[model samples]
Target chain A: MLCVVNTSAEELRRIALQHFARIGFAGASLNAIAEEAGLSKSSVLYHYSSKEALLAAAVEPAVDRLAEVIEGFTRTGRGAMDDEFVQRFVDLLLSHRLEVHVFINQGQSLADIPAIQRANALIQRLGDAVTDHIPTVRDRIRFGVALGGAAYVLVAAAQWSSEPLDDLDETRAALVDTITTLLADLPVSSAATA
Target chain B: MLCVVNTSAEELRRIALQHFARIGFAGASLNAIAEEAGLSKSSVLYHYSSKEALLAAAVEPAVDRLAEVIEGFTRTGRGAMDDEFVQRFVDLLLSHRLEVHVFINQGQSLADIPAIQRANALIQRLGDAVTDHIPTVRDRIRFGVALGGAAYVLVAAAQWSSEPLDDLDETRAALVDTITTLLADLPVSSAATA
Candidate 1:
């Protein structure tokens, strides 16, 4: 008898992430993912017990990376945290757009999953780290807006723009500067600077 | 022969919006909406040709109100545009949370619908209107962040908060102030004023 391993679990996860992002957690099917991975359904099930397991594996890396980013910020001092954090957070999110897409698409359905829960906690911590420096009620709200805007823009950039986001660095720099301004206590005049 | 018209189309739409927001577009069935509205499925179909039509009818008011808000802002001068625009926009969104929920949940699936397309164009126009005064790329992106943040916070507040959003007015005031801060061009120091 000849034995053959159809597809590795890692490859399944990679393909699953793409499917999840393109469709959604409920929309993505194990058979389609197996076919995309060039593996039989039985072989795919052998690696992961169910679709939920596959989703957990697929989203784990992105969640871990985000947790790491938050952890890295926590180790650093309060000064320049917002600048450094925004730069790193934007970079991470832009590079991992697919991951972010999949995670968001899952929405509330997969909220109870360990990976999703962990990511949420980490994100809450991350939000605190960002908003902690801003003393005023308004600035804190603005901080939330800054974070949401960055995420929304990075994710929806393709839909919003006719062409590729060529000015990514400029966008990142602008996002960092904007967040920094939001973090500050005083409001400056545009006419005064001009 | 007896004729009965138990539920109004407007009431059906109100209930439909709630269902669509709670579940989703595909997840929301006409039968379910009919049941919720205490109308027969045939009656629901009589009022609206299909589920898509019903969904469109439900979201149209919010979209139209948004259009009016943007138009109102255009008539005003540049100086008060940001403040007035943010105030009206925030108020509109906070009140019409269900409409926003249904629109967001549908995502790309209903993008091609005329109502959806019109809403998208109006939103694009809205973005342009808000960002028109900000000359730089960064501020423009910040403008987007402010808008996205406001939408996200309002929608996700129920899930993220343990209690009701009782401090909504304070939050609204803060968001307006934050956008005003982002709209400003100069980097005002935190210590300069204090």
Candidate 2:
């Protein structure tokens, strides 16, 4: 077959992700995104209605991808909500820190848009599914708390990361460790003992 | 002592924080802030140098105060860093989740300002001084990561507290548990032990 370089949607998406990362959602006008994507603005608009719609399409898949990562933990065993899974969840969350930031910051601004809302709703359902998989009643509650803690570690990681802790790698490793330990030592055991 | 129900400074700050919280830094207008604060537009300028300056003054204290709270842990346990001190550190951080939200959300918008820079430098110095007291080298390295994780928990706690986590009290308890556990199980403990 004769060569072709720009017709596929895959190439267009890759171009969009790079531009979006460099210029932020609001700053990256659709004109720029279309130019970067090697497609006519009309062609871009033909597939996605507006700049908001394009931004939503570009990022929401990553959200679904993360939710897919979390959903994998559901098969992690009877204590699907156990310490190991929770800790793994923390790693997954922090590893995708920039993506999480994109979602939290720009996602809300476009949240009322139908596609974005549906994507986030799917993310929520994944969380609920994870919680539902845990067998122990009290452990379920503790897991929920641990889940909350994991989310915090993510958002706060940047500011405190600059502190005099080890280098970035070591610091991230420590963060993961801290969350795992927290899950293992959840007060559930003590509550059961009491 | 005489007490006043409303003062110009207090009113302006209240208005500024609300507006900053609602629309973010680039989006909030000084005139809007003045209107919300119930002061003459000139009065806001009289109290603060510029819009960015006013925003910094309003937000930096919350960050400074957060650092002070974490710094309080040094005062506990024979004036040294210890497990009890870490627990109290977690408590201090979790207690002020909203302030954490304001600081993190507005931080980037105000990132380049002198006041915000000074405040962050102070917080970093405070963190360094605390880490200086630790005997175990690995523990010191991991401390920042652990702390970063704790900060993230506060942000996540705020989001969840809006609905599923219910009121702040329950959220606080949940956060305390998560952080305490994370501190206890730091991964570098293995290195510290070995």
Candidate 3:
């Protein structure tokens, strides 16, 4: 029903992300990736020339998904700002904080690798997209800070596993509520909300 | 003159931490440490017999400083539960963010080594001390989240050498304000008035 690249390329990317996340980039070898994907080594090489290339491709879905979520929040022409979408985004990040840890932790220097550097743009765009939708300077600041703060707390909890952060989730919810209230109060247009 | 630690053991510890931070624990060479410290290889050996011993000593100061800071805040007793102390603690971390980064960055795994791992208990004691000072659950929760968020951001910012966080001091202040506001509202007794 779909194109060939759509199916196999997507499948390979998924497999590669899973394996690299668990074992780390250096620990992840071509053979291991191939085995994880149930493919021959040669087949992987056919798709991506090097480990760097494979790693770059693997993060694409995550980048795209985040971009979509952020962009959906900021789509002012079509919709005012969707609190539900924002909540889901925050929830996704909190519940699967490990995915983010695996993404950033494995090596922040991945930006030096030519193909892998694109995620930087994706991250910036996500921030910009959300920041753009908010009308008031205070609201914009609140939105960015809340998002960043929540994300950071989740990572800290993961890193300081022994330290309890049951309260952090409550703080996170309160932060989101604050942002939502700020957005709702903004004197945007009727059509955008309607 | 100040009573500096003249013992061979203390001197070696001081010198090794400098080298380990500049290079990394794995990357630091024992011979180079001896050269910089103005001690012969034999003397360095007399103080710390192995490279691992030297490296463990190297990461200790930053971690020790962190414990010290945590302890200082905790020792303030019920005063630390106040918004002003929380704000000051946040300020302290931001001002010294760079030193914290050097200790935590690659040096975190130093905790795996038996000698340095004991230092983790000191750090945990500090965290425990934080809760012991708080009078209520809500203030305790607020303290944890704010401190956690501030620590995470300030450390990561050290990686970006070009950022003008050097001038505005915005990053640290922003974190403190976030924590202060969250705590102020969450608890009945405590108020974080920025």
Candidate 4:
């Protein structure tokens, strides 16, 4: 019974992504989504209930996939995640830039929504995965900072860059290099007094 | 004439900060601010006009202070920014946690406001202050990433920490270490090719 509903929801999610990308979260109304999907307004409402709900449905899969990737790192028993892993994570963020854009733009006001809360939890989990390997509190904080920094760049690269980012591959490589350097340098243990 | 206006405006901005910190940017109302400040609604409107306008007044001083700090770095002609400067920066950010929270939480959506736009431009300039000595594009990107990461942690620390962040000093040290590592690890020209 749920499988039948899942199919339609999946279809709606795909359509929602396109509408969101083109018109943004604010501009993409349920009526527009329904019109674009060739579905009745009531049908769309039945599945999504609201615009925020629709956005959550559209963004959840990507968040789930990201969680799985971070989970893999946690299970691997590595002391630190490599640049390749960081690069892969950046790629995921870049691929879902539209959704990321909306989630970030919504900020603290909409954080009470279940989907956004879950996504925030997942992000915390990802941050934990990167920092868990470091034994010292100081290094852990530093790792957290580096991770936060790399993620910020990936999420807001388009806005931060002076020139338009023409080559994403090069951008990815540069970001990986930055994260790699941050992870490689370990502070002296005695100096980490806190 | 402007002197008398500035005094009352300053008082209103101070009252607004307390309201904004307690209730958040979205939750803070102009009426609430006026009531809290012992001013009439019309008086508050005469001074600030809108909530965003009130926010602009409140956040501008902190931005100006930060700009001064960054300007010092730019004039120093140092190869790399020292830990003291970074610590001062971290302290400035931590002290203005409420304003930082509002600015970051607004994200890309409110960036078009003249105050927010000026703030963003100032942040870009700060990134430049640290990286201007470095010639390569990869190093510059890495520098930007570290700066963004440090800034994000500073802004979001209150929310992101699982427990209330009891020790800000430790957090500041850790962030400084992360940024220092990023600056120190400038790529060899050959290694920077991406």
User: Cα RMSDs of all predictions?
Assistant: 6.3, 6.7, 7.6, 6.8
Per-residue lDDT of candidate 4, residues B11-100 (tens digit): 899889766644456556778788877888899989887878888888887777777767766666563266656667667766776676
Model 4 segments more than 4 A misplaced? A1-48, A78-80, A101-111, A127-135, A162-164, A185-194, B1-47, B77-80, B104-108, B127-133, B162-164, B187-194
Candidate maximizing lDDT:
1
lDDT of candidate 3 at residue B23, scale 0 to 100: 43
lDDT by residue (A24-71, candidate 2, tens digit) is 454456676778777788888787777667666666666766666566
Worst 10 residues of 4 chain B by lDDT: B185-194
Q: Model 4: what TM-score for its first chain?
A: 0.63
The candidate that wins on DockQ is 1
Which segments of model 1 are wrong by more than 4 Å? A1-23, A27-49, A73-80, A101-106, A126-136, A186-194, B1-15, B29-49, B73-80, B101-107, B127-135, B186-194
Note the Cα lDDT for every prediction shown.
Answer: 0.68, 0.54, 0.56, 0.65
Ranking by TM-score: 1, 4, 2, 3
Badly placed stretches (over 4 Å) of model 2 are A1-49, A70-78, A82-91, A105-109, A126-177, A185-194, B1-12, B29-49, B70-79, B83-95, B105-109, B126-146, B160-174, B185-194
Candidate 4 whole-model C-alpha lDDT, 0 to 1? 0.65
lDDT score, candidate 1, position A56: 84
Across A33-139, the per-residue lDDT of candidate 1 in tens digits comes to: 98988889998898898887888887888888888787987666454354566677778777777676555534555687888778778766765665565565565
For model 2 the TM-score comes to 0.64
Q: What is the DockQ score of candidate 4, to 2 decimals?
A: 0.35
